[model samples]
Target: MRLRVQGLYVMDASKRSAHGNAYFTGFGKAKRIVFFDTLLEKHTLDEIESILAHELGHFKFGHVRQMILQAAIIAFIGFAALYWAFGSETFAGWFGLPHDPGVVLIALLFAKEPVSHLLHPLLAARSRKNEFEADDFARRIVGKEPMISALTRLTRDNLATLTPDPLYAKFYFSHPPVPMRVAQLRGAVEA
Candidate 1:
């Protein structure tokens, strides 16, 4: 079950953030695996290899495609709302939105900001779920203990917020918190 793909690209991102990351870029056969230089520098060979295993798991399970589809659907819904708003005077009147078409973009942004905040938790939950699936994929490839070690190492080296505010993490985090991910991996190993 070899996962076939394209190149691996390493990036220097230490100046931007205290973090280690790996991502799959491009699409289909052109996809490239990317690694932060900090990640290569900080982690052991096994840890880095386990991280790659996890990324491959994402591709194997089509998580990347699912995310793209989800994003497109959300964007479509947003555009549909805008189309309806622009076409109906009664809808515009209900919101007291300015009739000036040029200012609508700015007005829409202001209106959506608060609404986006309310949607943040749901979005974060979906993203965390995807991370868990990827972790499961990694675990299957590298074994749970190694996957846990890799995730833990990434968190420590990146100086991740170890004890984030629960509410804030729920609303903002794309990946599950480090300890939580480690525990999940441990649970998988036990089971």
Candidate 2:
């Protein structure tokens, strides 16, 4: 993992938002881990290390590449749909608009919410599963307590929902609710 890491950087994220976050960017041996300055200020060194371990898990599991591939597939489908719509004179006409690219784009914008609604559950489920795997990996690397503490702080600091409607979470959440994650961590520890 050390060999794969290219750099570690701290961004002045506090200037934009008080929310704390960290992420790894690039791919393979060129990967860089970037931490929000707010995260540095708010968390203990141990907590930061736990977060780093979680990110490392994503790399180890190739979650990043998988996400990119998923996005590419979605984009390809979207572009294909757009191409089809362009050729169909009835596309814009369905929206009571002219058969122009600009008008079609506007129609697509209006359609985006419903389309996203249909796709969100599947995408969110995959993302949540990845998050759980990452959390487990972090537990293996740094133990569960530090990661749990970090999650607790992040939830409080970010004003995140501790619990949410199950259906709503299925529709919109990419990560499981904090309480849910913490329970899973504790359960793993007990196991």
Candidate 3:
């Protein structure tokens, strides 16, 4: 689908695949955004536009840059910790590994999960905030009705429960709850 917004053409493509899920790629040189065609088929044009607006919000608000910086910092800290831990004979012997090259490799591989687990909650919270900012941008550009309807359809199609545990929502949900989003939109429309 090609959407002309603000004198630029946003082309949504569908060729990128990762772990059986569709990935969207934006080409700065071409000034186009490519996403899975299945998304287009499943959503109305207005909904698609809202999604695109959300993506543009990320671009406009420097969320992508923030994410890149966060990843870099995490990687640096992870590598530093792994290096320090692996250098200690006590740490190596505790994990049943020899103080050798193999031990270093094993530490690198095993450190990923622990690091990810430690950072998951903070990352999830940041992600949810970004989603709300994007939604606000989409609402401003496409109006509350289209964005709310689009969000509802997506929640229903994705089999997302209307209600979820607040703890789970804070720890995992990237987007706000459907009811909360819809209510916000409705309030905006009424105002």
Candidate 4:
């Protein structure tokens, strides 16, 4: 992803990796930001700006640092769990797995999948809260109408349903439901 400010665009090299799944473009000269093609499609100015504003919120609130710290903590915990679970030959034999540290590390990483799945809802809920905070920030800066219109357009473009299962949303979503978001914006506008 890229961030632009005063004619300069900053993008991490990792963004170009084959595993890259997100992209952002901003008017460096204009000090404007944009994120492209995630759950939302690129279409209409309002949609683009709304998404951009949300991303800008991340930058504004230091969410990136929070994400990094969270990842590091999780990784450390995962490693500790792995070590404790397979520290002994007897333990390895009990599981019928190899006793090699390298093999154990790999297995540990794979074993974390279920743990990750179980933690997904909590993570997604935090993410959704962050999204809401960003939306709130965007509305404050750009006015509720633009952000609302942008959100609506992007949701439609992305084929996001107006309503989603609460359980599924908690488990899988990183943003609030579109209708709820729009309502928030509207309420802000009315207030």
Judging by lDDT against the true structure, name the best candidate: 2
Candidate 3: where are CA atoms >4 Å away? 1-32, 93-98, 101-112, 186-191
Q: Which stretches of candidate 1 lie over 4 Å from their true place?
A: 15-18, 188-191
Look at candidate 4 and give me any clashing residue pairs. 7-28
RMSD each, Å? 2.5, 2.7, 5.5, 6.6
Writing each residue's lDDT as its tens digit, candidate 3 over 123-177 gives 9888777777777878888888888877777777667788998888877776678
Q: Against the unseen true structure, what C-alpha lDDT does each candidate score?
A: 0.79, 0.87, 0.68, 0.65
lDDT of 2 by residue, 84-172 (tens): 88899888888778888888887887787899889999999999888888999998999999999999999989988787898888788
Each prediction's TM-score against the native? 0.88, 0.87, 0.72, 0.69
- Candidate 2: give its CA RMSD in angstroms: 2.7
- Pick out the ten consecutive residues of candidate 3 with the lowest summed lDDT: 17-26
Which pairs of residues collide in candidate 1? Answer: none
**Candidate 4 structure, TM-score to reference:** 0.69
- Which sections of candidate 2 miss by over 4 Å? 1-3, 90-102, 188-191
Instruction: Quote the lDDT for 158 in model 2.
Output: 90
- Candidate number that wins on TM-score, 2 or 3: 2
Per-model clash counts, in order, read 0, 0, 1, 1
> How would you encode candidate 1's per-residue C-alpha lDDT over 1-191 as one tens digit per residue?
55557789988898897688999755667878899988888888888878898888778767788878878987998898788766766555666766666556566677688878887888889888878888887878778887888787877787777788877888899898887788788783221
**How should the candidates be ordered by TM-score, best one leading?**
1, 2, 3, 4
